[model samples]
Target chain A: EADIYQTPRYLVIGTGKKITLECSQTMGHDKMYWYQQDPGMELHLIHYSYGVNSTEKGDLSSESTVSRIRTEHFPLTLESARPSHTSQYLCASSLGRAETQYFGPGTRLLVL
Target chain B: QKEVEQDPGPLSVPEGAIVSLNCTYSNSAFQYFMWYRQYSRKGPELLMYTYSSGNKEDGRFTAQVDKSSKYISLFIRDSQPSDSATYLCAMSGQREAGKSTFGDGTTLTVKP
Candidate 1:
């Protein structure tokens, strides 16, 4: 089955902790994206990748970074987590730039 | 003003009722519109997608786009408890289809 997966569905970390969220898709998509969303709030794009070795910062400036080393994997890392970083991180992939995106189950991070 | 604006609705309705969700955009260049549904603590799943200005219906879900007014809507007939979730509206232009602008989602609950 074609699907996107994110690990560590729930996380709790203290301030200044380094953390990484893993995202992978089995659909062999070329476009991948990372979005930050608060519970019942708007979603903000944080990072995206057009293809392997191609990455760009999204509309919302984020403190995290992302890498697209392979077509199936796009991981997000926070250098130093803060309480303000407590939010849900969503990963999504698309076959093409104009195609609809399929999202993962999401990783919820709670930084204390 | 924001590129896309959506009312943050925590709307509660009885089961089998007709439910409507909407969003308005400030950009006239937007040509592609989409709706995504997110359950509690989960990533958004694409529900409806349309290009240009028109209406598209699939099963009990109907998506409408009015480019002249820069607005879009989603209507769900005979809403069920499974329909309880947050609905997000996203839009982008044909040329820059990868950079989609998203609106704040509206939360809906269908009670049995």
Candidate 2:
């Protein structure tokens, strides 16, 4: 089974508040990713990292930023949350480019 | 056009019924194909993975990939009510840490 985990499975916060979503994996995967998904919509990739200290923006434009200081942890931070930022955030990891990705339980954020 | 396309279906089926889900892609370079199942408010879990063409089966689930047509399918036989979830199709190309492109997902409900 995948050992990936996400913190604060559900969150409710006021607008303009700063929030951080934590993701960690015990599988020792080298690559990690963060995606934003709305109900009934496709998952849009926002950020991804290749091992430590390597981060890149994904296909979608996102206000949140991610850091990969350690191989197991990838955290996403939104400086100022908004109503539009209310959506499910998923974290995933893979051994390499062509490998299957394993995902965390996900975090549902509500920016009221 | 989107790289990958899938029907956004809230399809309801009785238990033990056969479930067929499909996805089409425009990117011929995509070498890896995958199916993921996500429950309500949860992140996706990798259900199946296929490389290039042909079929792969795991228990009640069968994944078929037609690289020539850029079409892929997942068939679930004797599906149980526990199988109810959103099924997403994802694909990636040859690059290391290649970002995956995802479909909108098809929601399946197997009612007992």
> Model 1, residue A107: what's the lDDT?
95
Candidate 2 reaches a DockQ of 0.69
Candidate 2: residue A36 Cα off by (Å) = 0.7
Docking class of 2: medium
Q: Which residue ranges in model 1 land beyond 4 Å of their true spot?
A: none
The lDDT of model 1 is 0.90
B14-112, model 2: which lDDT tens digit per residue?
999999999999988888899999998788888999889999999999999999999999999999999999999999888744468899999999999
The deviation in Å at residue B17 for candidate 2 is 1.4
TM-score of chain B of 2: 0.96
Tens digit of lDDT per residue, candidate 2, span A44-85? 989999889999999899999999999999999999999999
Task: Note the residue pairs that clash in candidate 2.
Answer: none
- Measured as a fraction from 0 to 1, the native contacts recovered by model 1 come to 0.63
